[model samples]
Target: MRLTYQTDYALRTLLYLSCLPEGKLANIQEIATVYAISQNHLMKIVHKLGKLEYIETIRGHKGGLRLKKKPEEINIGALVRMTEEDFYIVECFHQQTNRCLLSPVCQLRGVFQEAMAAFFRVLDNYTLADLIQDREMYEQLFEQKLIEIS
Candidate 1:
């Protein structure tokens, strides 16, 4: 199953911040430019993340955004869970679904549930730190540009 754009951006944003120097802040515009995403859309994800306390924002001069906690402190599974609202693998899994004829007999739900658990298990294995540890490689790939403060 593919994750939503919001989830994708959220992950990218988190990873970007995790890769930055400790206590350093990044602006939303810079993140958008680096990731090649729309500033408007990124803002929405950033707001949601800020609300979840995954990232914090500061306004005005010398202000930008930073991860609220260290990379190790963030859980990948939990982060995905926070960003992704709908995890239903099939129509039958939803609450408002029209009943499928095989709802009672089909083992598909259980199977899907197991698969979902496995997906989360894999994500849980990696923390934000794990994703950002290859700092030099990522810096080369994205060519991170630091903003100059006057």
Candidate 2:
């Protein structure tokens, strides 16, 4: 199943933060600029992330955002689950909205369910830290963007 833009942005935001040096913070504008995303949209994702405790937002002029937990502690599967609104890959998957008369006998639904389970099973094995294993690479990429923006 494809993820929504919100989930995509949240993952990107986390990745950007993960690339920062310890104790350093990043602003929403900077992240938006770096990723070429809408600042307004990123703000909403940031708010949700903060509420979810994935990132911490500090107030004041000098304040910024940073990860509240270690990268290794942030499970990718868990984060996806939190950020995603629903897992209804198929119409029949959503009971309330489903209109398929074949749902009861549909083996396709079971296959999709198993596929989704396997997908999550793989994501469950990874953490934010795993995604940033090439920390230096990501750091250089982000730094390059900052340099260009400057």
Candidate 3:
């Protein structure tokens, strides 16, 4: 049930961007520093997010990153699906690679599927805006992190 770091960072990056004042942009270095993540790793996630049009990037000195879409438009479930490589919670989940002998009669596969569906069902109820209901709190926390880093 653990998400990959890619998904984790992507969400964090989006959260950070959402907390910014209107028209303000943030750089990868600042984001990486804020979360104590690697700049190199964050770069890849940023590139993916940019390609996905989740975040728009502006280059050069004053250039930075901002969300292309409003937080309300960013669905947590949709983002999770895009960021995750696969939903293979078990060996039987992958059709081609599944070698489990019990897969043919396994009720557990259906159970897992139901669990995954339930998981997404909950996530589908939320958006980036929903995650930041306490937007001011998140803003203050990020500000404190920035101060600590400095």
TM-score of each: 0.90, 0.97, 0.98
Using lDDT, give the best candidate's number. Answer: 2
Better of 1 and 2 by lDDT: 2
Relative to the true structure, candidate 3 reaches a TM of 0.98
By summed lDDT, the worst window of 10 consecutive residues in model 3 runs over 103-112
Which residue pairs show backbone clashes in model 1?
none
In candidate 3 the C-alpha lDDT for residue 28 amounts to 96
lDDT of 3 by residue, 1-150 (tens): 779999999999999999999889999999999999999999999999999989999999899999999999999999999999999989999999999999879899999999999999999999999999999999999999999878
lDDT of candidate model 1 versus the reference:
0.87
Q: Report the C-alpha displacement of residue 65, candidate 2, in angstroms.
A: 0.3
State which candidate, 1 or 2, has the greater TM-score.
2
lDDT of 2: 0.96
What clash pairs does model 3 have? none
RMSD of 3: 0.7
